[model samples]
Target: MHAGTSNFLKAFPIKFAILIATFISLLLVGCSDEAPGAKVPAFKAPDSKAAAKSGAPGGKGPGGPGGRGNKTFAVEGYIAEFHKPSGSFQTMATLEALNRVELSAAANGRLVNLYAKDGASVQKGSLLAKIDDSELKAQLKQAESSLHLAQQKMERTKGLVEKNAATTTDMEAAEASLKSAEASVELIKAQIAKTEVRAPFSGKLGFVNVSVGAWVTTGTSIATLSEVTKLKAKFALPQRYATTLKVGNPITLIDEERAIQKVGKVTALDATISESSRTRQIMVTVDNSKGELIAGGYAKVSVELQSGRTQTIPVPAEALTLDKDGAYIFVVQDGKASMRRVETGLRTPIAVDVISGLNEGDTVITSGLISIRQGSSVRIREIRNNTDYEVD
Candidate 1:
């Protein structure tokens, strides 16, 4: 029995060596069986640790035929537009009346008639008030009588000179006296006309400084007149937008404090940038026939930047992702996510115009962007037709 045990021990080592040789041969044959450059289909393998805990193999067969990946990604997409036409920008603005004036007394006199009331509408050249002209009118009457007497003396002198009754020098002196009297009459008439005050233009009247029977002097401010039929808004922006600002461009007036809104057009632009603000001033004209807007009021001006280009590539603003490198986006191509860097141009509230790196018809992932890397295989479970705005 001792001799049989030694022989068995020796044979056991030889059998073990044979088993090792056979395993190496199988491994070599298995490696050579696959042809070079041939692809092996991939499939989700079970977890090795779980398989070992359950005492099962981790290997699994390839996915079902059709060359489609098994991993599915639920996501929403936005199709970029290549022909977006417009964009919007907003800025602070100041409202001013198209025409405003402070009516002042042109001459010193007692106010006899007050024709204009507070907040009253008056037409151009309309009567507003009249000052007492009693003294001036009396002087005008005396001047007219003196001028008539001077004219009679000049006529009598001319006839006497023709008949040799008077000299030519006396006739010339009479004519000069007649001219002096005529000048006095015109001066008094002009002074009397100044007593009647009139509106300079059509507008609404403000508070009056004097009432009837009150004494007023020249240069005394009487009231304010504003042409509220139309209004003008002035706003400023960076000098870079000088070329983009055009005559007749659209402008929207928004007064959030009073909840008022109106539309207007850019009437004029400053010739150069303002040195103090380093900005370009633009003027917008709006119709205020309804008297809704007040002069010297506050509001916001929204300017639409059309950039003169009718076509632009637009993508959802939220779809854009920013990094230190620059702006980038994830696009789905052939059921896979591809990350691409892009350059942006004009941006609106809803979307951004892509200047480069993306083309029309490129599907951009607007939703379900987390955890997806470049070249990630994805199965589209839901295709959203909304390509204009963000999902949320």
Candidate 2:
């Protein structure tokens, strides 16, 4: 039995070795078949510039996710082009009364009567108010009585002197007494006239603060009087228009308050230019006989010069960059900004006329001045035209 057991053990080692070899072969074949469909980590190519540029559909271009590194600036654009001036040139103007004054009491007295009410139209020399003149009247009566007695006495003295009954000194003294009484009467009469306040000129009157029996002093508050029969519309124009403006020149005033337009003449022009504004004052006299035009109302003045109209290139005043080198502007050409120096002419409130330095079809950058420099790339966000039509 022992010998049989030993032989079996020896045979078992070989059989076990054979069994292990068969299992290894089967595992190798199975792996080979599966390997055909297996996915090895995809051998990815290194990132290249071409890959980034030809990025996936609908991706940003050039610089990072946001695109090109050039800082993006939002700005407005304007086109410089020729424009015609209006048929008639218009300017800012203010309307004013031809004559305006606050009528005050000239003498100190109690107001006895007020002839006109507030907002009453009065004629020149018309009685406006009356002060208490009773005291003045009595003074005049007493002075006259004294003058009568003195005159009689002077006559008697002169007769006595002529007849040698009175001395020459007595005659001179009587004459002096008579003259003094007469002078007193005249002074009282003058005072009486002042008691009756009258309108100095034809105009419309305003409200009075005091009622009847109100004691008033010299230069006391009374009422306002303005001669609106003809209103004087005063406006200022640039000094360059001084020569063109002259007396008798036709002027049209637009009353903004009343929404009415009126025709008038250039009654006067200021002799000198105002140093502060460098403008000349023009006075237009408009007839307001119907009292339609109000004093102190605003108006727009326009004058049609008998000259031809012209076209000009106008740009916004903000676009101009001024320095020691003169005026310059940034113009966008071919996606790049270029600085161009230009000569400027007349300027209005919103725009300046480009007399030189720019031509038609020029695109001027109006905004984002700080974000851009010469040769900088720009994208147009919006555009505006500041050209204006003007009459020369």
Candidate 3:
């Protein structure tokens, strides 16, 4: 019985150990099934470190992307050669008029006749319009009759006074009567002449403001006449150029496109600068027999400053950019854009002169500049079969 009891105790201890092992294995299998997959989340590692640093009381890192630097900016520019003046700047052509006048009536009267129309050629002393003069002619006739009678009496009194047949006072009265009648006739004739309006100078007439039977007052404009056969353009120049400009100086007037249409000579220059504008007036005359030029047209004037020859670098105006440091451009080097600051001189609508900060044979990025910043990588596309570097 002691042996059997010892055997039962040994079997019991073995069974208890086996049950504890099986329970632990099942618990581990259940826990493993409940846990998540092995794939790690993106950026979680770095984010965890960032959160820890931020939560720290005295962290060194800035809050939420504030430590990032300036954003990259893209821009475009073009390559151009710098130019220095060779002889002188080209002359600019401008339109101007020398003399302008408005024709008006001298006396108040109804317009009886109009002989001239707009754009009509007229000569000096040519009759333009006529006012009613019937009353003036009747007064002239009466004065003439009185003068005839007065002269006859004066002749008789002179002979009588010489022959001692008339008193001295009577002779004097005859003389005064004759003079008064003659003066009255002349005054009436003068009024009659005023009725006929004549041209003061030979020129083409402008529009006539008054029509026949229209009552016009003194100093009312009748028409405008101008001599456009020869035109004069007057412009103001800075006082500094006053000394250089003189009468008879040859000037080439340039149209807006820098085309030289006419050559003119300086006719006059004001002696002093105007106090308000600090500019002196200059007058230039050009032959316009063809009537191609009209009055009051704008022109550009180019004057030769110095007689020295220098290389000039001309670039298109669109290739220029401006920043806080004046003007600049972008130059592409080894697939990277380099910011280059430039100095600009004369500027035209199409082109500008570069004074400094660029060299010949350098390629400049004229397009795609708005997408590039300094030291940015770029992909250059070749302009297929396009020789001209024109900006759209």
Task: Give the number of the best model, judged by TM-score.
Answer: 2
Residue range 1-392, candidate 1, lDDT tens digits: 99999999989988999999999988876788577556788998768555544435332322222322344676777776566444766888999999999888889999989998998999999888899899999999999999999999999999999999999899989999999999999999999888888888899998987788888999877789999999999999665455677899888999898899999999999898988877898999999999888889888988776675546577778788899999999989998889989998766667777879997888888876775667666656555554444211
C-alpha lDDT score of every prediction, in listed order: 0.81, 0.81, 0.71
Per-model root-mean-square deviation over C-alphas: 14.9, 11.4, 12.6
lDDT of 2 by residue, 184-255 (tens): 999999999988778889998989767888999988877888899898888888764566767998899887
Model 1 poorest ten-residue lDDT run: 59-68
- Candidate 1 yields a Cα-based lDDT of 0.81
Error of 2 at 380 (Å): 22
Model 2's TM-score against the true structure: 0.57
Question: Per-residue CA lDDT of candidate 3, range 145-217, in tens?
Answer: 9999999999999999999999999999999999999999999888888888888877788898889999887
Clashing pairs in 2: 84-389, 85-389, 85-390
Locate the minimum summed-lDDT window of 10 residues in model 2: 56-65
* Candidate scoring better on lDDT of 2 and 3: 2
Candidate 3 residue spans exceeding 4 A from truth: 1-96, 167-172, 257-260, 304-392
